[model samples]
Target: MTVLLTIIVVALVGITFWQMSKILKLSQLKNVDTSQVANDKDNDTQGKLMLGFVIFIYVLTIYCFSAYNSFFLPESASKHGVEYDQLMLISLVIIMITQIITQGLLHYFTFKYRGKSTNKALFFADNDKLEFVWTIIPVIVLSALIIYGLFTWSDIMNIDEEDGDPLIIELYAYQFDWRARYGGEDNVLGKANVRFIEGVNTLGVDVSDSYGKDDKIVNELHLPVNRKVIFKMRSQDVLHSAYMPFFRAQMNVVPGMITEFSYTPTKTTEEMRNSEFMVEKVATINDIRREKSKALIAAGDEGLETYEFDYYLLCNKICGASHYNMQMKIVVEPEEDYNAWLKEQQTFGEQMSAQASN
Candidate 1:
């Protein structure tokens, strides 16, 4: 069936090219008035058609913005999320306004000045004042945007180590998996080297460093809601990005150096799951999965299981063949629950000391 479809498509393309060649050869007439080929009547009709198309573009933009906006990630779950959202909204509004004004004038002019045999063409020259006005307007607008962006960028990048008890966590990226390490009471991560990675030292914590002795390692990330969490990110072999869409957080993990990003979790996993937006999202996902499950069943494969809402830490960069599956679960809970879970995890020192006894 695929071969048959390919042959049909190829035949259609060949016919189209052959017809185009014939038309080009036939249209090579010398001293022919170009406007005669496109008559005034045809141009007028085309101008009206273009005007309709402009309206269609406007309608489509409105419809898409109204219907598809809900499909985007729900409100961000970080302390700076509101600021990020406001910045995005401001940019979108500016873009939309520019698009509407330009398109409206373009189509209106096309329709109003459609070709006519009796109409005389007007001689026009460049207007210095008009050019200056256009140039200065954009310069002023862009300057404001640049100034606003600079302040926002500076604030987000500046991390105050002395600020209120910010949890120090390391996000380790590898080929197909992710590992997280928590700094002990000192709230400082020990030095690590890629060479020291072995069976259990997946994150290559320097055992010699006292700061690494009590550092906890975990498969899943757990954070306390409303607590400032600073991630010290590292990569093993290649570049990877730690991206949490919900928190509006992303940072590249370079192989040789550690990168950091800090954000406070404003919502818990359960709170996000139960939110009105997430409830709708889960229902939509389930509906899609149900359709996929039917196709899998027909192919003699196991049907897909129902999906649930959860926060995820995902690799946003294309690092390896298994990059798509490089993800880890994230859970945000109250401070007490997070502390209890943190206590249950084994520390680097305990794990290594136990291995020596074995």
Candidate 2:
């Protein structure tokens, strides 16, 4: 019913606009094209009105979008989200204001000297004062914006772990799959290398290292609230990107050498419901979506929706045909729940290991 009503309303609006346009064409106020006739005082008013209307509409559109973004979206993520909003707002304001001033001046100049009676061209080719003023003003504004953006970017990327709780996780990516390996109860990641990769040991865990035994491969990651998580990202097959739009974080995952990036998750799954950007942000919904969106054939029974959750992972890079299948899930929990979840995952890995031996 809602869809039908919406379609009917849209059709009505479209017909009304079409009729109004046809009526306007019938009573057209034509502008004189010839230079002399175009410069006539009688036609100048129309040109000025057109310019004014254009400027007003352009500025109105930009500001309205900025207002909707800042106030409409709930405060979900911390500095990352808010800074992006503020940056977008400032950028829109700057662009719209500059465009209006430049365009308005151009239109104003067009009419200001459009008199046909003046036979000769103006003697002055360029005004030195005008040149200096415009050049210096733009340079100053551009410099300020660049410096401000750099500082904001630096602050967002800084994830120092001198005092507060910081968890280090290894994120591995391949042709079309993502995986996360938590450091486990010991809180130290076991060594991993591409050269050590075999069919069964996909992650290339260094079994020689005693610590490697306890280091578990959790399909879904559970992060503690408000804790800084530094992910050591590596690509096994091709280049991939680690993207978390909600946190305003993305890093390139290159093969051979490992790339690193970090973000502190502030909003929980319950809190994410209120965020406007959250709808577009995939990190929170990644695991859930992956489980729900899995093909019935690949995942066994077609009726099954939910699958196992593992450490948070995703393939942001379009590597190959199966790139669509690349995904991993994350579950952000309270400190106690995160710890309990970690322990349970470790237990499950041990059980699976024992079963394989039998």
Candidate 3:
């Protein structure tokens, strides 16, 4: 009944609009004027409206940048994140400046020089100087941006192994879930093959391989603060992307191949959670959740829990129906706590040997 009423209301509104349009057309036809048909007032009104919209865009952009700053991810936790953020800011500033100039001029011209039948347009088939100015300016600007981008890419891709003793961790991607294998005290990951994956051997670490003996498989990813983490990524069935927004890290995980990305974690989960901005964000989230939970309870459904800040490893690629659920919790902690947790995990070889004995 409510839906029917809504449909009827919408139909009535549409019909009213149609009738108004028809009446306007008939009125214009009956009262046609030779001098006032295409007046400056109408053109100016339209141009002004467009210019007002542009101004609204500018104001909205500023409002969003300021008002919703806390909703954006907190400060990056990786070493190269500052550089990455600077590059992004440079690109955004360039784009915003160009947009403002072009849009302002476009609307201003429409208002400043409305169409007049007596006026003639200045036409030039070609202007080499003007064309060269526009072309060379963009070329130089784009070339510089491209060169700078290339240097950044090179720096990220070519990591110096000798710079620090990076911890090795393997990220295995499957259809609907993720698993992480940490290279134990040896700091070396053993050979892995998809074919050997069965039951408990989810990551297919070769038990026979000595290095694989100490490989620790875990559901959650744990990283030591202030230490470099080198993730060796792999996929069993389809392509996936490992994305960590807070760390400003993303890398492709291709099937039957290993891809690598390295980053140094600078902060722990507790530190991030305690940050003023994050604390405010959490309060906001919990407030929203409380309202949603009330609605859920009214509908006889489970209520939502309060929110907390935590690092996450999420799959960015759409692999399958369950792709959205492909994620793992990541915890950054002090070296001692991380090592203590690591030691408590069962090694692949130990699990395999125990199963064999059984």
Q: If scored against the real structure, what TM-score would every candidate get?
A: 0.88, 0.69, 0.86
Clashing pairs in 3: none
Rank by TM-score, highest first: 1, 3, 2
Total clashing pairs for each candidate: 0, 8, 0
**lDDT of all predictions:** 0.91, 0.71, 0.88
Per-residue C-alpha lDDT of model 1 across residues 1-35, encoded as one tens digit per residue: 99999999999999999999999878889865655
Q: Poorest 10 consecutive residues of model 2 by lDDT?
A: 303-312
lDDT of 2 by residue, 1-358 (tens): 9999999999999999999999977776677343555554554676567667767877787788886664354453544667777877798789979987787777777665554555566687889999999899999999999899998888777767663768988888887777778877776777778887765467877766666667767656667878888888888878888865556667899988888787777876546643455544444456666666566557675644443322335566788899778777666667887887777775324634775797
Q: TM-score for candidate 2, please give it.
A: 0.69
TM-score of 3: 0.86
> Candidate 3: which stretches are off by over 4 Å?
1-42, 299-301
Between candidates 1 and 3, the lDDT winner:
1
Model 2, position 304, has a per-residue lDDT of 40
- Candidate 2 yields a Cα-based lDDT of 0.71
Model 2 ranges with Cα > 4 A deviation:
1-79, 111-120, 274-314, 347-358
